[model samples]
Target: MSLVARAKSLANRDALTRVGLALTAAWLLLVLLFWLLGPTGTTEPSGLGRLVRVMGLVLPLALIWVGVSLGRSIEILRAEAADLRQQLGRPLGQDSHGRDAARAPMPAPTARPAAPPHGQAPAPAAAAPSAVAARPRPGDQRQTAMRFEPGQAQAPIDVTTLIRALNFPDGPDDHEAIDALRQALRDPDLSRVLRSAQDVVTLLAGHDVYMDMLPPNPAPAAVWRRFAEGQRGSGVAALGGIHDREALETVAQMMRQDEIFRDTAHHFLRHFDGLLARLVPELDELQIAVLADSRSSRAFMLLGRVAGSFG
Candidate 1:
């Protein structure tokens, strides 16, 4: 409000430079006004009074500018916080107090059950259970809705489509891969493997371990057949044939250090193992070799080798 206070507020380097230039121009205009309105030879107000008057107007305008800038900054911060909350699924059924709206209590029934018939034992009232278990998430093998049994899935996903879907779509425009993935998702057994493979592949991608980049050492049909027949350790060591040292080291480190990646890799390994069991029984040696060349198969080899699934 006071002239000194207003000037002190605007006295920062950037603001002072702008105000100094504005004051210089204001001084000239005030002088010109005084000359036009002056009584000849009579006294006029001092320069300090004119300076205070001009500064009173400019200071309010400067405060408005600073206020607008701060307001914009606050709005941007609030918007970013909102986006972060949305990303974290913060509004997933909880209210402001953190109580789940979805789990709100229902009103009790007003009437009790009718009395049983005379001379007969009274029937017990049946209590309705409303707490249904949460459905298993995608890639969770605990679900039996899609899975029939290990090596016994009834859904007929072909070996080729199953392999292509496991690799996932090459790009959004790769309609063939997308179609194959869709078909695999429809199949009971292949869907489980594809979903699990997707998790492992994505995690591996974070470490720059791409299935396509890791060329596995060729394994013969007999090795795959032995693995399919439930052999483990040294008996199936040939299946762990990916020899890229860098990729192997990265995966081995993750298997030891990263819990999520380790679990996902194991899950993918199990599903792929089951898939091999189911399909190897139905395919010829040529089809088995082609299956080995698939990206899904490569990921299995990389993971199996690192996790010592094949010793």
Candidate 2:
């Protein structure tokens, strides 16, 4: 069950308990008033006398029932809260995931060092064409400049560097990274690498890797087309059961490191962009609609916004 649903159920149970307690308290109050007034020494039985007698007999039993039910409800809520904490790896009240925490500002790229003064005869430019035909057209030169010879030096693909590059300037590109990671996770060829990773289990657990995080609302045909173009394995279907946020986050982290997912990463990145584009506006509209309603609407609106944003 979702955390919100569990919380709501607990709240309802507590409310029932409270109603029972309130009724008991009111009955006791009436009994106290009757005792002080002595049922107004009159002829027959008065309303106060009947009220006192009934309350004196029934209120204690009702209070006991309320106490027992309240205790049970508190226990259930406590257990649920503990489970939530364990799943999130921290206390619930501490903002364990800190989704609203402001992202650290990105530092600007440092400028390259200036070249030495020209008078010293600039050091020979690193590796250049030995000869340019005097009659060569500008277009020919441009083409030559862009050509890659077979023996030319090339940089190695440093995975760490690449992962870092994938990071956005201001914060982690969670949406983009998730898309790329999903593509990677779905690649059959990367299975061995993923299985071998030291953090694979935690990653999977955290992201609820086995759960389906797919948005439930109908998506544009273009979105499906984009997803289809890069899909590679049946593994994606395994995500249907996941309902935990931490598990989903862990899965995303794993995707970032899995080599199998690299080939289709770009497709996932694009899909992430598409998802954000679609969700943000819908959330804003829903928020506005919710704010126009009652105070209770705030809770529903917040939930809607969270679901929309995450999806």
Candidate 3:
């Protein structure tokens, strides 16, 4: 459905919107009475004059309150509608909980007896592959798109496979791999590790080395493990292909040690180290504003606290 209809449906369901509508009606009635029965000329100040005078003093304040309430109600409706859109846009086999109908483990196929000629007994059939097992693996379908779910644990970044893809003759323009990496970046849990590796990949592209050239040397599995563990030194060395060793090391160190890293990691990584330090606090402000309702945001608050404990 269209956003307006979706938003209206949400607003109609909200008690606060009903209250706002009542306040708006009251405000409009006061304005109409003041205009219609107000004293036109000096008549020794009648009862209507006194009533209009009192309403004149209260009308502006009441109108302001009504406006604020309606504005907030509309904003809440818009946010709910946007969330509905996200839910509706999910893939056909996937639900809002991230469960995939097609990803469920399949049972192994059993052998079937074969028909024999005339009255002869039938021979047993050979074992067959399961539905899931019959599906193509990465080796067979390298161009398959990746899926990202923010609430779930991310699969480990496959640097070896990524490097191999980058070294293809048409690697620079390997849209499938690039799209997969981009999709992976949307996972907040994997952003720190994935972004660092992506920086190295972006650097390689700038040096006339499209997917056709190697990254001088493949990073050892130990480096990737240390990266997954949030270690500073090994992670920096693992990304040596970036050319600017000193700069990468500095950013990595700050990201690992800073108190506000969890709150501002996305922004700092997007920009440089010192460019937007003040902006880090803004994330906390936004979290507080959005989490004002304890019931609605308790899970997110708990998750943030747990993630902070890791640091």
Candidate 4:
């Protein structure tokens, strides 16, 4: 048979096999019930026993057949997946002549409408490409607010750099870095990462983690002012002492997700890092090492390594 014919036949066979598997499963269950309800006495010489014995033999064969069918179906699926991967990996819009549509020169833009037949209150001009290019970037805008979209392209988190940035004294430089990091956290894509990290922080906070660690500000204004002025009185020892297993697991999971989603989880946790820096602007490598050694978990160990890099 032709390759296409064989593929079609395999697809049909797979569908039929699936349907048969469901029906056979139901039949097997019914047979099992019948066998269970059969006579209990060994000396009975009952017809039900004989019937069950025959079914027992038949059931094994049926199961073996089903297994083989499933195996065949899986093989067919694997083959199909391989084919699809190969096709998708090829350049888009490739023709029989092997020309790449993407590389083809684009057509010139159509000419604009002629000058509106002598100024009957002339039509509005379309904005030129140069005008668009001259517009300020979002980062340059004074009122720029962080916005997150769930499906935006993700970049990996630079764990070492992030740790150093977070540990930096709260000066104008660190404040700008913190603002950028906070904006990154507001991204919707990091929602899960944020929640997970927040859960860990909250769990630790429940144990009075930040009670003595944070500044004893009389008001919110004081807190904000302290953060703005780059104050650095608190020591790194204040950030240490957390050793909870559950919280460690949560942190580990956040790190794993950061690895998978790249910067997604890492940026999300930057919010916490900034908050910690605000609480202890004088945190040094030794203090970071103390926090890192608070638990033997992989997360803490990784944090320790990041902190040690600064030394």
Strongest candidate by TM-score: 1
The ten-residue window of minimal lDDT in model 4 covers 128-137
198-268 per-residue lDDT for model 4 (tens digits): 33322223222321122111112233234334443332222223344454454455455434322433443
Ranking by lDDT: 1, 4, 3, 2
Q: Can you give the TM-score per candidate against the true fold?
A: 0.50, 0.25, 0.27, 0.23
lDDT per residue for candidate 3 within 94-211, as digits (tens), equals: 3334333222222232332221111111232233211011111122122112233334445654432222222221222345444444544554534443443233222222222222
Who is ahead in TM-score, 1 or 2?
Answer: 1
Candidates 2 and 3 compared: the better one by TM-score is: 3
- Best candidate according to lDDT: 1
Model 1 alpha-carbon miss at residue 212, Å: 1.1
Q: 1-311, model 2: which lDDT tens digit per residue? A: 24654676677677767877777777778778877887566677789988987887786867678676877677676655554444434211112242222222222323222211210112334421221111111211110000111232234322322121122111122243333333333433232222222122212222333111221222233333333344323322221222345544444443455443322333333344343343223332222121112111111112222223223
Q: Which is superior by lDDT, 1 or 4?
A: 1
lDDT, residue 270, candidate 4: 50
Candidate 4 — which residues are off by over 4 angstroms?
1-44, 94-311
| Residue range 138-238, candidate 1, lDDT tens digits | 22111111111234334676665665565455444446566667777776667678767766665555455656556556677888898899988888898
Compute the lDDT for candidate 2.
Answer: 0.33
For lDDT, candidate 1 versus 3, the one ahead is 1
lDDT for position 174 in model 3: 46
